[model samples]
Target: MENLERMEGQCLCGKVTVTAGRRDAVEACHCGMCRQWGGGPYLAVHCDSDVQFVGLENITVYNSSDWAERGFCSECGTHLFYKLKGAEEYAIPAGLFQSGSDFSMTSQIFIDRKPGYYSFANITPEMTEGEVFARYTP
Candidate 1:
């Protein structure tokens, strides 16, 4: 994580700023809830607990699931992050970052739920919905 450089980002309106000090490879989530939330699979970067938010007044968090919540800019409605309710981990949209972040698509979750209309060329690991839940079970 020390090698992963810090990155800076902001929403479309510049009312919300995201700064992350640690992050792992990017990931794509193909769950129906993700599609419904963003009109497509969520291409996200895993920042774990290292993301910092500036201008939080413009950020609104919605509890999308029992254990998860999603964040967006209240002023511009730019999708921010999907976070675990019990932890500080965050999955923020990869596009939101303005800096050239050092991340690669290394995994895709809910592979079985991915629609047939499109596909990613990355030869990354894939996990089905059940596999995802099993790994994250509490």
Candidate 2:
């Protein structure tokens, strides 16, 4: 795993906070479920298992899939993280961290499902839905 730097961020309402170790590479998920959840691709950074969340009561979790769950701030409806079940791994929204302005768009996943209405200007590496499943699924 790449060495990660400590990062911190808070929800829009300031009701919840998150601290984690993150890399500078940001990835975009263009899967249908992700688009439906955020009304667009989810731009996030993969976080280490050392993620910490404050204000537990202000957070809500949804079982988005059998192997993963999504978290958000209940008070402000701010999306927090997409976490894999039975693991400490998390994909945190890149926009949440103000310090992440230097992050670079490195790659995109589920390219096959991306809508034609929009496109990213960066010519980053991409993975198709099948490619993503094959690489990530156990």
lDDT of 2 by residue, 1-138 (tens): 455568899999999999987678899999999999999999998887888999999999999999899999999999999988998889999999999988999999999999999999999999999999899899
Model 2 regions more than 4 Å off: 1-4
Question: How many pairs of residues collide in each model?
Answer: 0, 0
The Cα local distance difference test for each model comes to 0.89, 0.93
Error of 2 at 122 (Å): 1.0
* Residue pairs with backbone atoms closer than 3 Å in model 2 (clashes): none
What TM-scores do the predictions have? 0.93, 0.95
- Candidate 1 C-alpha error for residue 43, in Å: 0.8
The true-versus-predicted C-alpha distance at residue 125 of model 2, in Å, is 1.3
TM-score, prediction 2: 0.95
Candidate 1 Cα errors over 4 Å, as ranges: 22-24
Candidate 1, 73-121: lDDT as tens digits: 9999999999989898888899887654556788999999999999999
